[model samples]
Target: MTERHNAFFTDIAEATRLTQAGRLGEATALIQRSLGGANLSAEGARPTDASPAPHGTPRLEGPATRLDPEVDAAQATLIPERLRENIDHVMQGLRSLVPSLNGLTGGGQQAPGPNGTEPDGVASEGGQFVERSFSNAAGARDYKLFIPSPRSGPRPLLVMLHGCSQSPEDFAAGTRMNTLAEEEGVYVAYPRQTSRANAQKCWNWFEPGDQGREMGEAGIVAGLVRAICAEHSIDRSRIYIAGLSAGGAAAANIARAYPDLFAGLGVHSGLAAGCARDLSSALSAMRVGAPGAAEPGGAAGFGAGAVTQKLRVPTIVFHGEGDGTVHPRNADAVLAQAGIEALTPRQEGGINGRHSYTRTRYADDAGRIQVEAWSVQGAGHAWCGGSSAGSYTDPNGPDASRAMLDFFLSHSLTGGQG
Candidate 1:
């Protein structure tokens, strides 16, 4: 058996043994360790050439916690047939035990209401939540909008894209963006990815077709933004986009493709655009950061002799130093891709009450802050300073959403309407 598969079974066996011995904490830790890097295909393995589904296949809408068929096939091939049933049983046991363990460990449980709103008991007084949809030639996507009441005038719009396996409500509850929006009088838009496009509901950032302007998911999201702006009194110059994980990668892709559409970009736990062109390369980039020199043309096909004006939109990046899924080094790669230069030495300390972080500020020739990279100490592949109400959040890290908003609000498009 390959070492990867061996390690997987070994960890499972060890976790099961620990659970049987009543050492729940150790068992849980073992399970979490095993889960990390679990999706990686075996080294030197290539994905099978599976044909696309028929055009009439109904698109699945909702949370995507299940594995994709391609991923399942790859995983199934790794394990021996005899061990498959045992692995499944152990996983089921872990799933049952995790909730109880979480309760003991003070993990927050999400209480989702109808239409992805908070439970009725929880008051949503300050802002109004509305579900909206946008369609274009690229595709159609549903989104959740949080509009603060009593708007004095045109307010800034913040486009939030959720990570894989996350919903708009869950993302909002975790990031607490709605609360911030109410305080700052900002409009928040959350574009939801459908399972029809990606089984994991992740933006297809690795696909070349999705990396350009007016194309693929990026085009669809931009269309949604335009529709939102047209419908609401929004400051087109103050529009911004931010996201986490796969969504984070998509945010960068959008910013690069449509720099005129956003004032700034925020990427948290995401890879740089054009870092990978396929699943294997993407996995490698996530595991070891992007290899070789940074991509030329600024990740948006803005090569020399391009007719349209090109601008390096302001960017802010946050990464957990201990992120096993996307290495922290990817943050530097992103900064480099954006042509941001570090102006000062890295500073380390507990900026918040939670995790200590090493922060570095970058600026352009004009001395304006163009990029800021924060490496949160002792954090995992989760949203920093996020509420436990959502999945993949670490409450013990600096508030990324607030920081991104502050950065976004501080900058405006140099010369663009929308």
Candidate 2:
């Protein structure tokens, strides 16, 4: 690797190690120094009596948690060494807490995935929870795979990406995807994002470097999917992916980067691709969402000098009206990428004994539900209708897992979207 590239990975690892050691200030500071010294701070860690946005409320700012890591020569030059030194304290802290992902990193061939199955949750059902690793030009990360019991014909594949500070086991247990995967005879893959990649293990959804068709995190994830397809008898046409928070954002970007590979997508509490250009924009997007998502091109083709291909995969989005982290406005952004604004929506929903939701379905000329979105009232930044055994789950909300799977089964690569 070039000196600059090696330095990039090294700094990422060091920053993450510091954050894991309860040295967040040092972690972000380390990142600032590397990225020409911007700044990082933790403020607004309390709620206010302020009114929420008419559609989706801004995520309540709070104490700085582990921030994401993203970098590249292009991004380094975008923010000069002297920048952010004079910005307002709150904006300084907000921008400081997030990282970048300009497209100028990653360029390696993927090594074969050498792995084996181990016993876990679905073992009794004759299934296997296997741990594996995928390394390429970008970097190396571990991921877990849940293979259902031996079935007759080919089965579908669902790629599950976890949010920050979560593991495959934790996400699997909370989402309860394994049991459902076995019951439905599907294969579930949970890709791991290391602290070395981001202190909080957040997918670098805001990074331009990570958004490219075959570079950085996006490339690694796509490469892994290809490897799995080669090794397993996966129903190539029924492959799908989903995630929460940062992972949700990453899933959107990766699916867009590889439209022909994935048939459908599910994003829960995540922003659309290109919604963020940097740390400050990322914070604003999480709060009230970035502007221009509903414009002619949507976020996929928005941003300054960043023109992306229109999203093609069928998508299902879920967000809590009460979530204070990633706002509900972002859900609209995600739907905008589905390119279904012209289609008439069939809306039908109400409180399900626990939480009220507005489910909107958009159909094409052929009558296929091209887009599906759910907004749960009184829900926070947690997975809806998820099992309490795991973390960040709201059991009272609608069953998102079941609903997403059904959406995936209904679509396929052959005719997912035009």
Q: Flag regions of model 2 displaced more than 4 Å.
A: 1-124, 292-309, 415-418
Q: What is the TM-score of each candidate against the true structure?
A: 0.67, 0.68
lDDT per model vs. reference: 0.69, 0.70
Q: Model 1 over residues 55-164: C-alpha lDDT tens digits?
A: 24421222223222222244455554545555556667765665455433222222345564464312246676665656778876767788787777889999998887
User: CA shift at 416, candidate 1, in angstroms?
Assistant: 12
True lDDT of residue 8, candidate 2: 65
Clashes of each: 0, 10
